[model samples]
Target: MRIRIVGTGRAVPAERLTTRALEAKLSLAEGALEAVTGVVERYVCSAESQIDLACAAAALALADAGVEPGAVDLIIGGCGVPYQPLPATAPLGMQRLGMADGAAAAFD
Candidate 1:
C-alpha cells in the first residue's frame, strides 16, 4: 500500500498579536508575555470566528490535494477554541467551504 499526504493545512488568525500589543493590553512588563508563552508574536483569531479560519484552511488543503470539493471522503477539524459554545466547528467549515451542505461529521 502506498500512503500519501493527500491534504495538509494550517489555520492562522487574521490578526497578529505582537509582544508589544500584549504588553499594552495586559499592562505587563516588556517581553513578559513572550517569556511566559515563549512566543514573540502569535496569530490571534479573536477578531474572526474559529469556523471561518477552519474553512479557509480546509479549502487550501483540498486545493493542495488536487481533489474536488465533492470528492472528500472525510473531514476532520480540531481546535482548542471553537467559535460557539455549541455546534461543532467542522460543520460550519464544511458549509463555508461549499463541500456538502452540512453533511460532514465533525469532531472536537
Candidate 2:
C-alpha cells in the first residue's frame, strides 16, 4: 500500500521571538544564533497546551488536503515538546480534533 501525506501543518506560538530579540534575554550578540542556524526568528509555544497547537495544525493540514477531520484514518504528530506526562500528545490532539476514538493515532 502507498501511504500519502495528504495534510501538512505547522504551529507557532502567538509570541514572536527573533534572534535580535533573544539577544537581550540570553545576553548574546545580535544575530549570534542566526549566524550559525540561519534562523532569524522562531516560534515558541505559549502556556497553552501542546494538544491545542497540534489540533490547530491538524485542522489546517486537513483543510489544505481537502479532507474532513472525521475522514482521517490516522494522525501522527511528531513534536519535540509534549503537553503532559501521562497521556501521549496524539490522543489529546485527536480528542481536540473531534476524531473518533479509533479513527487515528498520534505520536510525539
Candidate 3:
C-alpha cells in the first residue's frame, strides 16, 4: 500500500528563548552556540506538556485535511521515545484528537 500525506502541522510553545539567553544560561560566550549550532532561537514549553503540543498539532493537521478526527483510521506516532514512560502517548493522542473509537494507534 502507498501512503499519501494529506496535511501537516506544527505546534510551537509560546516561549521563545533566543541563543543569547541560552548562551548565558549555559555560561558560554555570546554567539558561540549560534555560530556552531545555527539555532537562533527555540520554543520552550512552560505550561503545555509534550502531549498538549502533539494534540494541538494534530488538530491543525485534521483541520488542514478538511476532515474530522473520526475520519482517521490509524494513528502512528513517531520520534521513538515517549515524552515519559507509562501509559503510551499514542492512545492519549488518539483520544485528544477525538478518536473515541475505531482508530488503531501505534508508535515507531
Candidate 4:
C-alpha cells in the first residue's frame, strides 16, 4: 500500500498581540521583546482554547480531504508550547475531531 498525505490545515486566534503592545503592557523598554526574541507579533487566544484551535484546523483538514471524522485512522499532534505535558495532544485532537475512543490511533 502507498502511504500518502491527504490533507493539511492550520489555525490562529483572532486576537493579535504585537511586540510593541506587549512591551507597553509589560512596561518594558522599547523593542525589548523584539530585541530579545525577534518576534514582532503573535496570536493570542481571546475565546478559544488550545483544543478549539486544534479542532478548527483539523476540521478544515477533514473538509479539504473530504473525509468524515469516522474515516480517520490516525492523528499526529504536537504543541509548540504544550499547555499540559501529560495526555498527548493527538488523542485530544482526535476527540475534538469527533472520533470516538479507539476509532483512531494517535501520537504526540
Candidate 5:
C-alpha cells in the first residue's frame, strides 16, 4: 500500500500564557522555563474543549486536503485524555467533523 500525507492544520486557543507567566506560576526565576523548554508562550482554552480544538484542526486539515468530512476513511485522536469516558475521543472528533461512519484510533 502507498501512503502519503495530504494536508495539515493547526488551531490554538485565544488565550495565551507567556513564559514569564509560567515562570511566575512555577515560582521560578523569570525566563527559567524558557531557558529550559525553549517555549515562549502557550495557548490555553477558555471555553473550547480539547475535542473542539481537535475537530477544528481536523476540519482545517480536511480542507487543506480538499476532502470533505464524509470522505475521511479513518480518524486518529492523539490527545492524552479522552473527551468522554464511554466512547473514545477519536470517534468524538470524527463525529464532530461529521464523519460518523469513519474508523477511529486514539493514541496518547
Candidate 6:
C-alpha cells in the first residue's frame, strides 16, 4: 500500500540551553561542542512528560493536515527508548490526539 504524510509539526520546551552555555557549564572550550555536534541550542523539559511533548506536536500536525482525530486511520510513535517502559506511548498519544479507542490503530 502507498502511504502519504499529510503534515508535520515540531514542539520544544519553553526553556532552552544554548551550546555555548552548556560549554561553560561543562567547563569545555566555547564553540567546541557546537563545532562537533552542530547543535546551537536544546530545549530543557522541566515538568513536561514525553507524552505531553508528543501530543503538542501531534496537535499541530493534525491542524496542519486539516484532519480531525477520528479521521486518522493509524498512529505510530517512536523514540530512542520507551519513555516509561509501560502502557506504550502510542496509545497515550492517540488519546491525547483526541482519537477514541478503536478509532485508529496505534503502535510504537
Predicted candidate 4 versus true structure: per-residue lDDT over 37-103, tens digit per residue: 9999999998988888889999989899988989987787878877577777888888777789889
- Estimate, for each residue in 38-62, the C-alpha lDDT of model 5 and write its tens digit: 9999888898898888888888898
Window of ten residues with lowest summed lDDT in model 6: 79-88
- Candidate 1, superposed: residue stretches over 4 Å from native: 1-4, 101-104
Instruction: Give residue 104's error in model 4 in angstroms.
Output: 1.1
The predictions' CA RMSDs to the true structure, in order, are 2.7, 2.1, 1.9, 2.0, 2.5, 1.6
lDDT of 2 by residue, 1-108 (tens): 878997788776797788888877999987788888898888776675677777878888998899988887776667676567657788778877877777865565
lDDT of 6 at 108: 89
TM-score of 1: 0.77
TM-scores, all models, native as reference: 0.77, 0.80, 0.85, 0.82, 0.79, 0.86
Give me the candidate number with maximum TM-score.
6
Q: What is the lDDT of residue 88 in candidate 4?
A: 77
- What is the alpha-carbon lDDT of model 2 when measured against the actual structure? 0.78
lDDT of 6: 0.88
Q: Give the clashing pairs for model 1.
A: none
- Rate residue 36 of model 2 by lDDT: 88
The residue-by-residue lDDT of candidate 1 on 1-108, one tens digit each, is 654669877778878888989899989999888888888888876777777677777778888898777877566667776667666677667777777664655556
Clashing pairs in 3: none
Candidate-wise lDDT, in order = 0.74, 0.78, 0.80, 0.86, 0.78, 0.88
How many times do residue backbones clash in model 2? 0
Better of 5 and 6 by lDDT: 6
